[model samples]
Target: MRRAIYTGIEAFGSILEGNPKKNVIALPILQEVSDLPCDTGSELKDLQIEIEQKDLPVDLRFVEENWSEKSGKYEPTSEKIRDRAREARCWLKERPESEIVVVSHGGFLHFLTDDWEDGHKFEGIRQSHHL
Candidate 1:
């Protein structure tokens, strides 16, 4: 998680080189809304601190819902993933920013973009599907 967070910060830094006020938002890795037992908010909180310490000219925001994964163990279904993805897509469309940078995990990203064509090729360690 630490490595991922650092790598994300580095990537964000690179993006900032071209545009300092690039709108940035992140999908919760494991937030309060998640049904998962463990949460990654602490690590993300640390990420927020690091962003501040580095003096990066951007405000990182999070989606209220944990749309990254299924709600809980019992509600395991692809339908839910699709619904959440649609919800996320709609929320993004409502944002005022003309160009927003969304930081998210690969699996959920697949759903968010409604693209499942590259499933086989992106198997294992493929964490990004570029927009």
Candidate 2:
């Protein structure tokens, strides 16, 4: 599959301070952002609950690999990040679309885009997660 990389976030915690409902300028290409988490504290779940209270159009869909209420990375220890990527690819392939926007955490993007690797063009992204 062909792909092009894009920039959006600075620090993971910054997303928490952001308001996706009225602050669409920060997030584009989609009215929704898939809260990319591997069961980690993306802080999006708490926000989701809060957003639901007000009834906003900014859709926040949590992918199974990236959401946890207990805390810590809530992902399966056995599941490699690539596995999630494969599943996502298959799922997207089924849905025909000319353009798709995938909103994810830095950790997920680091591994998925493999942009953190030396010589990678997107090495400009801040490396907050080691692995």
Candidate 3:
């Protein structure tokens, strides 16, 4: 999560440097991590602190449960994943931001982005959880 935030800041800082009118909003999905002891609530709080300390213009939106992990213990079927992805895509399309940066686990990244051509792209995403 930290890496993704840092990357987003670094990646977009320059492009948005001189544009005061532009806005950057972060919508971290409300995901459940079964592998981890706790959930992402604390992480989001910490992230909020970091953003405040930096005085970033990022507007932290509500926790989006739509993109959360699989509902059951077992892994979701491919069709289910696709359905979730489609639903996520629909939700995202309604957002006001012109550009959005998503930072999520490996299992959901491809599904969210619909970029299955390059499997290696998601190699760095954590493997502790799956969608």
Candidate 4:
């Protein structure tokens, strides 16, 4: 039983340490429809503090894409997503040894993977596949 406990503890430790803690680039989403009710600026500030506490870098940017008020939905234009991916790809490419955390909307993440959809479906941005 003691041996089993030790093994379990070791496994948990490995799981925690295996993943590299590094920079995270957050993607901007609609504040009105986000999970958090707080403003984007406040959220960003909080996220920055969390990243700092975790000994990681917080590198974030807002996509320059604007949606039409009349349409009441995001346009099918890939420019914004493309721009975000470009930035992420550049950072990842430069530092092949480091791990990056991208905090963005589900749609933006999908765009990074080149799999855009009308609905909010998450297929996850697999690091290995993209890098």
Q: Which candidate number has the best TM-score?
A: 3
Q: Model 3: per-residue lDDT, tens digit, 41-130?
A: 345566678879987756667544332333442134444546656666777789788876665556556766767775553243345434
> For model 4, how many clashes?
1
lDDT of candidate 4? 0.39
Q: Arrange candidates, best TM-score first.
A: 3, 1, 2, 4
Q: What residue pairs are clashing in model 2?
A: 37-66, 38-66, 39-74
The residue-level lDDT of candidate 2 at 18 comes to 53
Error of 4 at 4 (Å): 32
TM-scores of the candidates in the order shown? 0.52, 0.42, 0.56, 0.37
RMSD of each: 7.3, 10.3, 5.5, 12.3
Tens-digit per-residue lDDT, 62-127, candidate 4: 422332121223323344336546665665578666544333445455656666456544233223
lDDT of 3 at 125: 32
Model 3, runs deviating above 4 Å: 18-21, 30-42, 64-84, 97-106, 118-131
Model 2: residues with Cα > 4 Å off, grouped in runs:
1-39, 42-48, 60-66, 69-79, 118-131
Q: Per-residue lDDT of 19-119 in model 2, one digit per residue for the tens?
A: 54322121111111122332224345554565467543343443232344322333322134545555556665675655555655544555545566544
Q: Write the per-residue lDDT of candidate 1 for residues 1-131, one digit (tens) a residue.
A: 23334546677767656675563445443122223433234444566677688765445575333333434421224545456677778888898878766655565577677677865423432233222
